[model samples]
Target: MTKTYEESSQTGDFLEALRLAVERARTEHSPTDGMIDWRVAAIRGQRGGIAGLNLITVVIEVKQV
Candidate 1:
């Protein structure tokens, strides 16, 4: 199975939310040496069930370099 960094944003727009997510991820997870790069294998937003009407899930992943 492919493994990726997953995060959630509270924005209706995917692109806008992604920008913020990436920045946060980089700062939090990026190495101090700066030898690693995160490649987005997939970024998706899914709708939740009836309970979470406006719940948005953001899934981010690093693909094979």
Candidate 2:
């Protein structure tokens, strides 16, 4: 299913919030002796309603720090 603008925006916001939370937690609780990276590994989907699928998509990206 195609994502609506609201949905996409919400997802992006959620990811950003999560990244910030993680960074804060790491700074407070974990030692910062090494580099850190946050990334979206993948989003995989196949297109179909009730029968054979016609499309497949997978998105993957590294989050920039």
Candidate 3:
């Protein structure tokens, strides 16, 4: 079965937030079954309010190779 991973990050820099979100997804991934196929399912960004920070979300899908 395929597995889905979701990660989010908030930072003042847009690139930083995206990098953090992707890093989180990679850190949480388990490769127990062997080499796996992975893809980015979605990327979302939103304003975090008065602070002007950005909230970034990344979704990943994975399955055994």
Candidate 4:
């Protein structure tokens, strides 16, 4: 199986973390969604999924404040 690729952050800025993740997805030419596991990640907990792509299936998660 192909390994999942993700970008996660814990900078304490929720929007910034989401922004960076979305930017990473587009730059990497991939949709983020389940590509990340934030809790065990560089950040922790689920703030919810922020949609970046046309399909609702694609999402970017942010760290909770």
TM of each candidate vs. truth? 0.45, 0.30, 0.57, 0.35
Clashing pairs in 3: none
Each model's total of backbone clashes: 0, 0, 0, 0
Residue-level lDDT of model 3, residues 4-65, one tens digit each, is: 76667665354554555455545666556534566777878788568786777777777634
lDDT leader:
3
lDDT of 4 by residue, 39-65 (tens): 312344344448332211123443422
User: Which pairs of residues collide in candidate 4?
Assistant: none
Residue 62 in candidate 1 has what lDDT? Answer: 40
Clashes of 4: 0
TM-score of 3: 0.57
Residue-level lDDT of model 1, residues 1-65, one tens digit each, is 33355555665566665666566666666656643355555555556666554434455554333
lDDT-based ranking = 3, 1, 4, 2
lDDT of 4 at 15: 56
RMSD of each: 4.2, 11.6, 3.5, 13.6
Candidate 3 C-alpha RMSD relative to the actual structure? 3.5
**What is residue 64's positional error in candidate 1, in angstroms?**
10
Model 1 worst lDDT window (10 residues): 56-65
Worst lDDT window (10 residues) for model 2?
Answer: 1-10
Q: Which 10 consecutive positions of candidate 3 have the poorest summed lDDT?
A: 12-21
